[model samples]
Target: MLLILLFFVAMWAGAQNALAGGGSFLTLPTLMLTGMDARAANVTSCVALFPAQIATGWTGRDLSRGAAGLSLRTLFIISIVGGAVGAVILLLTPPAFFARLVPWLVLFATAVFAYGSFLRKPGEANAHLSPRGAMASQFLISVYGGYFGGGIGFLMVAALTMAGQNVRIAAATKNVLAAVMNASAVAIFLFSPDLHLAQALVTSLGATIGGVVGARLLHHIPDKWLRIVVIIIGALLTLGLFLRAP
Candidate 1:
């Protein structure tokens, strides 16, 4: 059972990375169902996902030349602040608050994720964003990402579309933002006594390898079918969270 669960975790993480969304929608719940306590599951997933984010970010850069770099650096700075604030909240707030909110947030994220492919119009290939608008939106989404990253890719995609970027560019930026938020939260969680560092490390390694492979395959794939698959997964994830929430 453990081995099978781990295999599912790797494949799910790989597919989610390939699709440019965070895989916490799959990983977090899986970990919890496997008997990890909720907080520990969240923290462990954050740690495991860090390496995946790095791999995906590098892949995005390879695909987009310097464009990915520009967007990544911008999103990273905003995410750092947001993640730190969220970590503080997690440490201080009641777990019940977050528990009640996760399902609703997942639902909203799914809706946003579903419409992400259409956010930009035809021929708007370049990002025509004002620096101020991009920064502000990045900051806001970072807060959301830091708190709960289920559909953070969609939020970032929405922000990028508002800034007039194409789906590809939005995706690259989303990867960077997800990386920063997870990294920050993971760092904070490392000091916790309850975290299982060994399992987390193993999971992170799997996610990293999967992310690199997925990034390599992203451009060659037909995204319409991929998008449909992701929407279905997102809906399932959303329903699962709702059912699990207290």
Candidate 2:
């Protein structure tokens, strides 16, 4: 049981690092299937992802120079507001809405990631949206981010591409904003009844290790292959969501 659990955790870490989206979709379902309640699964996944984001941030600090490093203050402020708003929205809404929206959102995100090549220039830096607009999009994304971060990275990447930013800058900006969403959601979970602290801790440890490895290996990986695989997974997840619908 322990080895199996660790194996899943490791796989989750790799997926999280490679895609920056859909990591939770893989791990959370596994936890639920293993007998965790749905809410607990989300809480546990959030806990695991918190450290993973932190590790990514730390390891990628030097990579954020130039355009990516500019306007971080605006990004951070927008993220906080967006995270807070998203958290409140989650507390007020029923879970059914998320179940309905997730598939569409996943498919949209997948499309954006997969088609990023055709839509933007090769190695372009900050392509289309203004900094202010980018910040606003980040805030909006935080709303979704606070509830489920599955494809948040893809959304961020798209936003950055639309804004004419380079991939590295977009990725860096996405991580910072994502960290805000994760931190805020984690805080809410800490006080909520659904959290499983023990499970969260263990999963977090695994995610941390995986994040470090992912960050270190980021440059060497084939992003095109990774994006293709994630798109297929997202499509499948979307199909499941549709099938499960009434």
Q: Which residue runs of candidate 2 sit more than 4 Å off their true CA positions?
A: 15-21, 36-40, 63-70, 117-127, 216-220
Per-model CA lDDT versus the true structure: 0.68, 0.65
The Cα error of candidate 1 at residue 8, in Å, is 3.0
Q: After superposition, how far is residue 231 of candidate 2 from its true place, in Å?
A: 1.9
TM-score of 2: 0.79
Q: Give the backbone clash total of model 2.
A: 9
Please provide, for model 1 over 119-237, each residue's C-alpha lDDT reduced to its tens digit, 9 standing for 90 to 100.
64554445455767677767777766666666677767666765766667666766666777777877787887646776676677667667667767878878777767667777897
Please state every model's RMSD to the true fold in angstroms: 3.6, 3.5
Candidate achieving the largest TM-score: 1
Candidate 1 collision pairs: none
Cα misplacement distance, residue 222 of candidate 2 (Å): 2.4
lDDT for 107 (candidate 2): 67
